[model samples]
Target: MRRRGGARRAPAAKEGGGAPSRPPAPPQREKLAVSTPFFAVIGLGAFSAWRGMFSLDTVRVLNAYAFLIAAPAMVLRVMSREPVAALWNGLFFAAMALLGVAVLACGILLFRRLAGLPFPTAVSRSQCLVGGNFTFLGVPLMLAFMGDRAAAPIVIALIVDTALIVPLSIGLIEAGRGGGSPWRIGLRLVRGTLVNPFMLSILGGLALSLSGLVLPEPVDRFLLFLGSSAAPVGIFALGIAAFLWARSGDLQWRIVMPLVAGKLILHPLLTWFVLAVLLRLDPLWVQAGVLYAAVPIAANVFIISERFETGSRPIAVAIVISTALAALTYPFAIWAISG
Candidate 1:
């Protein structure tokens, strides 16, 4: 074909030295965003427990599905396609390391200078607040509000979970005084992360979206139907995790309440101020920040506790407690920025 003002554009280069002038587009992520006070309903349940309005059992189921089933499915679908280089690059690893370090470093500094609490208390509080329930609450909550635009923020959340959350939690698990293999622990961490159902499902959905492959009408309809269930399932799972977590005796109001305070209030505010005001991040990014902040402390906090036997019980209470309290704070945060 004759070129119009393009006098034979340079021949497409070969593989080793020069490739195509443009890099292939990154995969497009697709997500669901549904925003209604869905979480408010959850808050009500948690609140009921607090007020003796309803039993806490309702909350445990909500948390359970989100963590156990949905999250693993979503992650597998997503992580399966991760470019090998993307998985292995030192720079990416470093960023995650720094974020993880920042979590602990900030935790120590804050606890020492400001919290004036025990070392473990400071550490647990910061860790729970900074990291989030990305796969569980984050996916649905964003979809409820932002819909398909939910995809990008979900991506950011995943990166945060993989790079920041996983490493930090492992380090905390292995704290000092031994010859246990760090790599062994790291591998175990990676293994657990990779198996998250919601993560896998999101990845599957995103893959289809990026491949220019539309689900057949019936399939699409089914997915939509299933997708609609995302929030309720998540909330129920939250309820369950909460219920189970709540049963532990002598609930540490001193530690648990502070973690809730940090997760529900401070976390979102800091994210909004930084991402929205300071960085002028994309509006979607701001939304992601809000999602990150608004999410209750992760079930993983309890998981880490269970695994390493680090303060798991309190963290569990914190997750359940934070989520319920978040009902009040989440809406306000959204309202503040809705302008």
Candidate 2:
């Protein structure tokens, strides 16, 4: 059977066969080698952050491409192969959606109890605490640890969380603010969410997943090749964003500290708790939550603030500090919850 997101088939264990017909072991070993470069990518980000030279926004775009570009492309290929019955294997996606919403809620609750901060402070902190650097940090990290094919679930998670979870949250949060027209705002939101690249990709991927559809050989290779670029290039963009942040030096400690704690510690725990307790997600999913949990705050928080005159100081600081501390926290989180 053909698989999604990769050209490399796994090596099945041979029965009492005289000689095995396998795609050379070297390729398989090389496939796992993807892990090595991922570490290098992380190191590059960390180093770039320290040196304060590269462009962090560039990293952001790299991340944007995975969800914005590669994800949809891969989804098209994956969609081509799914079976009818399996197309509705949406339990995982639905579960993930709940997890995203829950994390946002947890961030708000934690912010209130721990900090007693004001509205914008709370909003900024909650946004960072809830919505992670899912695209930039999570993608590379997952690709490194899991490799290309296995990264599909996390990619799906990324797309879903971005297109559906975040937009909905923002829409609700802004609903009471007395905009031009509530109906108009609602309509805009619907259109925005519907046409969202990430959401569309998820739908496509889910269709393919359920249908058990297979892609043409050339298409599969192309998807794999593009999907594979996600980690390294994305990390580079993150580094560039960091450099820009460093140059700005607009660090705000008030919003920063709590954001760091909630994102690095509380968010992951909330994810694990929600998955294992509330949703009772499978172990693999629980692991996915754990891994994705360690992602930094979105760089967009800063961009949105800077570009639209909104404030995301808390978001920016969290992005910087959370990532810095996650080096220690992530592995511990995996060890603590995963085993």
Candidate 3:
């Protein structure tokens, strides 16, 4: 009876073993493996661009498909499935976006005055400081890091940037150009936001969510199929566009250096402070906000400049440099958020 109470002994090591094996060094931490898919997509895009896998016209078509078809489907799928309570986060997203824009806009204004930039140039540059590549770069990166659950916060942030920040930038640029009635500008902003395919999809999704209507099985499956294509296609398109923009012309160090620094560093820091420290949002939300802030300036900056017939060269240079540098800065941003 006493012998039966003894504890079981561990298995003996092999004769040649000096000590028990130490679990393979915990798999070497897999530092780069986590980011492998993201960087792979980016590398493919770069190669595509360098090899001319897609022409300019073909690239535009691909972008349109991603934006209008694939991306909107993903947005709708996520938003429609999200609870109405989750949708309330849009207000916080809008607030954070507005705060980031205001902070950066002020900095840009001060820099513009000190540098003696023209009004149109100043406005365009300020827009670049605030606007981000949320859909193209931000969405894919977040999906890569956080998976499908990230879509909700990302979509909300996209809405805020597209609806509020974008219009404000456009209005400022328009105001700088000449005179326009405030009412007209406001109306245009509203109409533009409402009419956007991306925004419209989000609204439809919200409406469905609020209405408590479940998507039919066929519809749901269709959306999932389309949504699945958004990340790869959008990232590839971004790479191609970035390559073309970088080759557009010679870099202007004076303007580009500041723009890149502000976008990749200052914007994210301010966003993190506002969302994580001040508002105390969910960690995921804070991370999503900061990540969106850290992306390069949206391609819309150049389009808006062209539309308004304002400064385009500087904006293009800023986009190219910021995007290229982001290949480095984004990884750091991810690590910061993860840590």
The TM-score ranking, best first, is 3, 2, 1
1-339, model 1: which lDDT tens digit per residue?
A: 111232322322221233324333222221111333566555544455556544545545655655565454444333333322222323323333454456556766776588585554455556786767656566766655554444445554676675556565566546532326877766766676666554455456555544534345565455455455555666655664565557654588986786788777767776676666665554545655676667778766666656655556777888877777666666566565554
TM-score of each: 0.68, 0.73, 0.83
Model 1 reaches what TM-score against the true structure? 0.68
lDDT per residue as tens, model 2, 1-339: 454455534321111222224333234444334334544566687577667554555565566786577655644554444333323325556766776676666666766688775443454456776677665566655545544333445655766666765665556455534445878878878888888876676676666566555766887789778766655566566655554564566777765776777677777887778767876655555666677776666665665445433355446656766666665676566456534
TM-score, structure 3 vs. true = 0.83
lDDT ranking of the models: 3, 2, 1
**Model 2 error, position 24 (Å):** 20
Q: What does candidate 3's lDDT look like per residue over 145-197, in tens digits?
A: 65545656766787777777777778777777665888887788788888898
Judge candidate 2 against the unseen true structure and give its global Cα lDDT, from 0 to 1: 0.59
Whole-model lDDT per candidate? 0.56, 0.59, 0.73
Any runs in candidate 1 off by more than 4 Å, and if so which? 1-37, 40-65, 71-101, 109-123, 175-179, 202-206, 240-248
Q: Best by lDDT, which number?
A: 3
